[model samples]
Each structure stands twice: as C-alpha cells, then as structure tokens.
Target: MTISSAHPETEPKWWKEATVYQIYPASFKDSNNDGWGDMKGIASKLEYIKDLGADAIWISPFYDSPQDDMGYDIANYEKVWPTYGTNEDCFALIDKTHKLGMKFITDLVINHCSSEHEWFKESRSSKTNPKRDWFFWRAPKGYDADGAPIPPNNWRSYFGGSAWTFDETTNEFYLRLFCSTQPDLNWENEDCRKAIYESAVGYWLDHGVDGFRIDVGSLYSKVVGLPDAPVIDKNTKWQASDAFTMNGPRIHEFHQEMNKFMRDRVKDGREIMTVGEMQHASDETKKLYTSASRHELSELFNFSHTDVELPSSAKTWSHLN
Candidate 1:
C-alpha cells in the first residue's frame, strides 16, 4: 500500500500495508462441528483469509475465562480457553499463521481480569493480602441509616450498575468499570504491573504473538483520588464517569513503559504492533497515542467519527437515537 514518495528515503513497515481480519473464536469456524470454533479451526482457514487479501489475523480474547462478558473477563492470560481448545492448539495456530505469511494478533484484555482469576481471588481474600493492592478496593463511603454500607462513589458501570461491587468477606468494594465479574486491575502497583507483564504480555510476546489489540487502554489509569463523577441523569444515582476515567494522566507514560518493554524484547529487529482501543478519546489524544516520536503505540482505535450516534452527555456506551 505504500506509494511513491518524492523523497526516496522511505522505509515501509509491515503493518503499514497489512489488512487485518478480526476473528471471534466462538463462531468463526468450527472444525469438530461442535457448534463452536477453536484455535485449530481458525488455523484451518488461514489460506482463505490470506487469499481474501488479509495480511494479518487479529483474534479476539480466547483466554481462559468464565465466559463472562463474552470472554473479555480473562481468568488466565497464559492458558487458552478449553472451549476454544488447549494451549498446544493456540501455539500451533500461531505457528501456522506465521508459516502462511500472516501475522497473528490477540486481544489483550488487561483493563480488567475475571473475578475468578487467582490474582483477583487472592486480592479479594483479605485486605491484608500481599495482592490486595493489585486491585482498586475502597472502603464504603459510609453506612446508611439502616447500617447498610454505601458504595464509595456514584460512578456507573458500562453494563448499567454501580462500578463498585461489595465483597462480604473483605467488607470492602472493588472497582469494575465494566461487568462486576471483571474487577479492574490497579496498574498503579508496580509489582502488579510487573506480574501482569510476565503472565500476560511477556508470555505471549515470548511466544510467537505478533501484536496486541489493547482493550480499554484509555481507562488504564484512573484519577488518583477516586472522585465521584458529576451527575447527569436526575433519575439515576449512578453518574457518568468519563471525566475521571477517560484519558487518565499516566496513560501515555504507561503505554510508553509497555512500548519500551516490547522494544527491549525485540530480537533481530522485529516490530511488534500495539493498537489501543478507546472509544471516547479525542483526535488530539489519539495522535499522541500513536505518535512515533512518543513511543507509545503503533496505532489506536478511536470512535471520534462513529460517536455521533451516542448522546452528548457522558453516558455509558449504548446505541441511542
């Protein structure tokens, strides 16, 4: 896809001309006719995708999960979901994809992990646990007249409820911007971030993964103080949270750290692509996110144009007139 430049000093990157086809493993192609697609099933259709003019395949989350939030809530980043096949099948698919001259990319759902995840399990087990700080657990704002505890804030989850979910064992609440089953990871903890990198990013990159489509990258770093969002709709206590969540202060810094790690892992000049998925970011923010000089990301998925269908007020994502 590269064109003739007036200056002859142009070097083209693989992704610049790559046509990536996204695959949802659940229904993409079925090999065993089990009514569900597996990693091998996707591997079987590589030639078809390549012939259709695709240079790369970006597969959605097939990580071990509890099938909550359509597998966006990952329980184990290192293991392939049993429904989608085993780890061997995933590795074989990666190898086959590379052999077919097509790059393989996988969705990185690092914004949150399944509540069933061991990290989350340990985090919620006790307030004194070493991993307790790995997640955003907050004390109740206060107790009501009846002595029932109130949530830390009025922030709304994207799935239409309070973002904070209470735990009976810990007597505290944990933040989940999306489904309650997906507890948001606290990237503020350097140890937590390192563990995530080892188990998720480093593990995959060490394998043959060519890139990652980072889910909800803009919401990675929330406002430090965890302030309540401004109220929008009068009828609902839950408030829109774009002001505190979207484009957090250290987003670029975090991305740069990831980019640096990716670069450091490079062997023989291989370029690993990274595209952040953020629907609410402005064009200016996206520019910085993808700027080569910034060393942030290879690209960014933004919905500045397609957001017209959304309401002007800071509401959770939904189709609206």
Candidate 2:
C-alpha cells in the first residue's frame, strides 16, 4: 500500500518532511565543567544531530529564570540564563544550526511567567498598579465558616492544592495554575497580549529562530468569571475540571492573533512552523487548532499516550513489546 498527499499542488515545508529532535539543554551535554549543559555544547554537537537524521532541533527553555521550574518559569524573555551561557552564545547556536541546514526551534512559554518577572512583580505590588490586570487577580469568594477567605473558585492547581493564592498586601487572590512562582497570564488583557507577543514571539523570530514549541498553549484563554469546577471525586483534592481551563472560549481567537503576526513576517519561500503543547483538549479542539484554514498551528503535541503507566509490582523491570 502507498500513501500520498491529498493536496499535491501545495509544497510541503521542511518541517512537514523533516524529523524533529527534542533536547533538554540542561541534560544534553556540558562543554565546560559547569554541571549544566550550555548552548556552546549544543553548537559543538551539530554534526552529531545532523548525522542522527534530525532536520530540526527543539531545545527546552534556557531563558533567564530562577530555575524553580527548570527554565519553564521565565523571568527575562530575551536574556539567556547565565549558567547556560550568554545571549551571544544562543545567537551563535542558531547560526550554527542554520549553517548545518537544520532548523532551530525554541520553547515558547507564554501561558505563565515566574513571579520574579518585572511584570508580575509590578502586578502584585498593589491593586492600583497598571500591570495588575496583566495577570489574573480576583476578590475572594467571601469568608469561609471560620472567617478565613476562600478562593474565588474551586479551581485547583495543576501541581496541586488551590489554584488561587491570597495576597495579604493586595487583599485579593491571584491565580497561579502551576507553582506559586509561576503565575498564569491574563490573555483577556489586550496590553498584556501585545507585550507578550512583542517580547516572547517577535523577539525570537526576529532573531531568526525557525519555529517554536509552544508550552501549555491550550491553557492561554480561560473562561470568563472563573466559575467553579464540578467535583470529580469527593476524596480527591483537585476539584476543577479541565474543560473550562484547557481549551477555553477564546483559544482560537488568541491563536489566530498569533498566526496573523507570524504570517505578516513570513517570507515567500521561508515558512515558519508552530507546534502547540495542547493538553486535555478534545479531538475537535485539536483539529481546529491545527487546521490550515484556522491559521493556528502546524501541529500539536498530543499527550494522551503519556498517561500510560505500569503497575507498582511491575515497576522493577518493565520492557516494551
């Protein structure tokens, strides 16, 4: 049996025809005796990647961070983490990868940022701060039985416990989907969206990054009002349903906005590819997100298979069939 492209008129980009290699920079290789892998190490190993038949290389986050989430929690969008080398090293890596005819992909994490970020710091400083709306901040749902303020909603954190954290200074609750240091961005705010686009996406693309592996892309646009999630189990801690958070109401709208930005910058022969890390989304949502007409993304990273696990008794030594 043979398979063919349904649309032969359209030429497939390098991404569609190429094999991708994902490398977590911290563990890939260490050029210096610095314990952590750096971009210089990656640049030095270009031949190895090329010989491995990888057409593109996607490196995990190496942005300036506190390393709370191992580079996922970004503090400075454009600056490189000092331990991973200077910003010049990163630029050189991109050049080296392109020189080898390999596309360079960087991880784009826009969903949430580290609390140490200037924007977050300003947002959390006071309720009257102009950047306060950049992140999701809301009043409590009134005092509990013991007079303690409850979270705005029953939504639980992705890591664990309540998603909303109370701020004594601001006298309000701020939503953090992941670790306390990683506060979810408010996509509803146009200013916030514009700032993020100009920095995270535009900054990298302008510097010649071939593409992006967007992290937690599906959790960008959450439902309005922050409604309570239905209880899945009485004994369990996390009560929120991903239905409202995973693929929110304006998800496509947000992606389309990003698509337009990318389209305007794309040259005639040079095309950029985007792959979103979509979690807990339905089949229809995935289809819409990756559809060509929708102008959202080129592909998606489906994590359904990651849920597979082995029994505790078989943990000693399990082999794939």
Candidate 3:
C-alpha cells in the first residue's frame, strides 16, 4: 500500500486538526421565512459553527434538483438552485466561512445524476444517440428457460423493486442503483468518467471550495458482466440488491484517477480533503479506503456502528474486536 507523502512545505496545519460540521442545508435553519434553509441561512450561522470548535463546514447538496430525493437528484452541476440562492449567494457563504477561518466543503453526488439532467435525457432517447452509452443500458432478456422477459439480473434498487427500469421508448432497461429516476452512469466509458471527474470535481476546485464530501462514492463502477446475484436469504419478500453492485470492480481504479486529477490541479499543493459516504463497508474495506497508499479515499463514513444493535451480539463485538 502506497501512502501519499505530504509535502511539508505545502500542507495546511488546519486540515490535520480540522473538525468538520456537517450542515443538512434543508433542516439547518431558515433565513427568509420560506421555511427552507438556504445559503443565507448558512451564512447567518457561521459564528455558530466557529463557536462549536469546528474548523470547516460540509454543506449538503444545494444544486438545482427535483428534491424528489431531497436534493440527492441534482439537475445542474454548475449552478446553485434558485431556492437555495444564486451562485453569488454561495460565494458569499464561502467568503463568510473563510472570514471565520473555517474552510467550506460541498457534497458531490457523482455515481448518478438526476433523471432530468440533459445527459440522461439524451441517453434515454435512443440507443444510437451520442450519449446513449453514457449510462448503462442493456437489452431486456426476452425469454428464460420458462419463456418470460427476464430482467438483466436479480438486482433490486435501494428504494424498492427492480434496479433495471424498462424504458418504453428505447425498449431497453437502464440500470438505476438508487431510485428509478437516478440512472447510474457508465463509468467504464472513459468519456463518461472523464466528463464527470472534470465537471464535478474540477469545476468546484476552480471555484475555490476547500473540498468535497462524496455521496455514494463507492458505487461509481459496476461489474463488467452485469451478472445476476445469488439469492442467499429467503426470509424477506422484498430485498435490496445493493450488495451485488455497491462497490463494483473498478472502484479503486476510478478513485486513483480522480485523486490524481485533484492533486494535479491544486493551486498551492494543498491536498484536497475528501470523505466518502460508505454505507456498508466492512473493516477490510475501511482499511483499504484509509490506507496511506491506496489512492482511494482519504477518509470514509462507515455506518457499521449506526446499523448494529449494541450490547446484544457478542459476534458483532467480536467482529469489531
């Protein structure tokens, strides 16, 4: 494992000791009496963040989204939602954060884009469209041994039901790891990967934000074969098939490229701090992410503790031990 060597001259002392305050923008506070939190609301709370001993703030997604998934479905990458405020409002918030000696980080949802996004719209139109391959689309299996339209696999979505959504216009099933509207991008396509890496990360880096909190960061890549998953448990009538595609084959390679892109674009050699939201990562996965030389992720948000019922199972305790 190769750990990234910190350049003593360029590293920021604050990063090593930084305490981050995560602000769920919609619920944090409302400023304009609109009953929804916006940039102005965050700006109003800068002193509060500083008073809490945090050195930086990580704001949830505030981009133009349908709000179907509570802002997880981003409609535009470059512009801030009008309900949140203008781009200028974001700049103001950043300025206020820096004035209090706190760095600012924003959420980046790259694994999938809102179904309303232009790329997805185009991709869903026709198979021959230029952007059709931008997302994962597979022909529906017309017949199995029993003769029925078999889904691409036995994968279920995190929300519910099948992960493969049949598009009537194109007669193809597009893979949606999350909600039906959030189509998963095909990271295997170099153009698709490069476009996302540059547009999402590069645009923000150029905008002077300190860093990013990557959402669903591990689901960027899918197993190339797109094979059906084995049904291990039969107790539940409905089950989510996330295990089959969550941390797909090329996740590490994709992250390495993203890391290199980030490092190469740093203005003064300050390492870009990134925290990945890893939902079901095991101890081994955690180590891979945080290992010094992995080039995968700097830090990971593992929800293992949150999911476990404490003091009940010695086996769980043993797993941790």
Candidate 4:
C-alpha cells in the first residue's frame, strides 16, 4: 500500500498499509452454536481472516454490559460479557490473532458508561457522593408552561427526546447524550479521567490490546453553562445543535493527554494505534486530529462520506434528487 518515494526518506508505517477488518462479535460467527458469537468463534475464524488478507481486526465491544445499546453501554471494562465467553476466552483470541500475525483492537466506548456501572451507581446515589461530579448533572432551568420541570437546555439526544433525564432521588437532571442508560462521563474531572485510563485504557493496553477506536471522541467536552441550543424549527420541540457539544473547547487538550498516556504505555517501541470516531467533524478538524504534530489521534472516522444522506438544514436531509 506504500508508494515508492523518490526521496526514499518517507515511508508509510505498517498501519498505513494494514487492511483492517471490523468485526461485530455478536454476529460474526457462532462456535458454540448457541445463536451468539463468542471469543471461541473469533478464534475459529483466524484462518479465514488471514486468508481474507486482513492485517488487523477491530472487534466491537464485548465487555460486561446490560445490552441496552448492544455492548456500547459498558458496565465493566475489565470483564468479558458472559454471552461472549470468559476473560480467558478473550485472551485466547488475542493470542491466536497475534500468532496469525494480525493486530487486535477493541472499541473504546468511554464517552458514556452503562448506568448499571458501579461508578454511575455511586454517582447517582447522593448529591454529595464523591463520584457525583463524575457525570454532568444540572438543576432544572425552570418550570414549563404546564408547570412541569424543564431540562437545563433544549438539546436533544441522538436517539430522540431531551438529553437530560430527571433523577427522582436527587431532584436534578443528568445528561445522557445517547441512551438514558448511557450517561456521558465528565472528562473535566481529572480524577474521572485518571480512573478511566487506569481501569479502561491502560488495563487493556497492558493486557496486549493494540489500541482503541475511541467512540464519540469529539464530544467529550461540552460547553460550560449548558446554554440552550438555537431552535431550528419553530414547531419542532427539539433542537439539532452540535455546535456547543461537538469539538468542544478542551477536545485537543484531552486528546493530547490520551496520546501522552498511550505513548508512555508503549515506550518500548511497540506500535500503538488510535482512531477517533468523530461525527460531523470538518475537514480542518480531521486534519488537525490526525496530524502527527498534533499528537491527537492516528486517524479519525468522519461520518460525512459514510452517511447516505446530507443534512440540508438542522431539520431535514437533502437526499439525492
């Protein structure tokens, strides 16, 4: 995949030449034939993957989860999902993949963790909980025309409805950018970031994982003050506003911190890759994200080309006429 350079000084890295195959573990293959694919199934397909000319494989989340949003709502990053098999099975698959000369990577869904996660459970236990600040929780802006408590802003969830969910016990609302069960993490909290690295990123990197495909990498930092998004349609109840959320003020800083950590992990010269999944990022942002001088990410997944339709406005898409 590398082209011959007349200067002979520039050469693309192995990853640049790698043909990566993405595997949705739940549906790839079923070794046990229990109607669900497991680690054993992945192991059984090494020959096929090798023959298919893949140099690396990116497996979707198989971590312990409630399956609310498939395995994206991770409850425990260190443990394997029961239906996907045990931790040993995961290690076995990694070993087999390495033996076959293929790199192994996994999805890093750090933007949000399952509400069932112990961290989230403690965060929601009390307003005074030490972990309470680990998530974005805010007071209601005020009561609506019907006297119902309104969320802090008019921001809508990616799935639908308001992004804020009221907590009965706390009498406050917590932000859930995707599913209500997947509460967004507060990367602003240094302790929270440290814990994520120790428990999620570092843990896997140390256990032989090549790298991560960071989920929602650009949406980690949100605009402070939680301003109401500009309403696109007067009749529509929800606002389609990523201006305040996507590519936030501290995104570069956060990514740099992550890059430093990853570099430190593989100081022994091992190749580690990181690709951020950023939706709606512009070409300029994409360039800055992947530039070596920026030390942000190895690459980025921009949804522009993949999306079948283009958003003509915030309210509607402009499909091919």
Query: Which candidate ranks first by lDDT, i.e. highest?
Result: 1
Tell me how far the alpha carbon of residue 293 in candidate 1 is from the true structure, in angstroms, after superposition: 1.0
Question: lDDT tens string, model 4, 1-321?
Answer: 242445665456667668888889999999888999999998989889989999889999999999999898999999999999999999988889888888898899998999999999999999999999999989888987998789988988887789989988788899998889999999999999999988889888887888788888888988987788897756667676588888999999999998898889775577788988887677888888888888999888766765556443443221111
Writing each residue's lDDT as its tens digit, candidate 1 over 1-321 gives: 232445666446788678899999999999898899998899889999999989899999999999878889899999999989999999999999988888999888888999999999999989899999999999999999999989999998888879999899889999999888999999999999888888889899988899998888888888998998987877789987878888998888889998898888767577898987877776788889988889988887666676566776543452111
lDDT of 3: 0.78
- From the highest lDDT down, the ranking of the candidates is 1, 4, 2, 3
Q: Candidate 1 local accuracy as lDDT?
A: 0.87
TM-score, ranked from best to worst: 1, 4, 2, 3
lDDT of 2 by residue, 154-179 (tens): 87776778998888878889999887
Cα-based lDDT for every prediction: 0.87, 0.85, 0.78, 0.85
TM-scores, each model vs. reference: 0.94, 0.91, 0.87, 0.93
- Model 1 regions lying over 4 Å from their true place: 1-11, 318-321
The window of 10 residues in a row where model 1 has the poorest summed lDDT is: 312-321
Mark the 10 consecutive residues where model 3 has the least summed lDDT.
312-321
Q: Which stretches of candidate 4 lie over 4 Å from their true place?
A: 1-11, 145-147, 306-309, 313-321
Highest TM-score against the true fold, candidate: 1
Compared to the true structure, candidate 1 yields what TM-score? 0.94
Q: State in Å the error of residue 272, model 3.
A: 1.2
Model 4 whole-model lDDT (C-alpha atoms): 0.85
Deviation in angstroms for 291 in model 3? 2.2
Of candidate 2, the 10-residue stretch with the lowest lDDT total is: 312-321
lDDT of residue 38 for candidate 1: 92
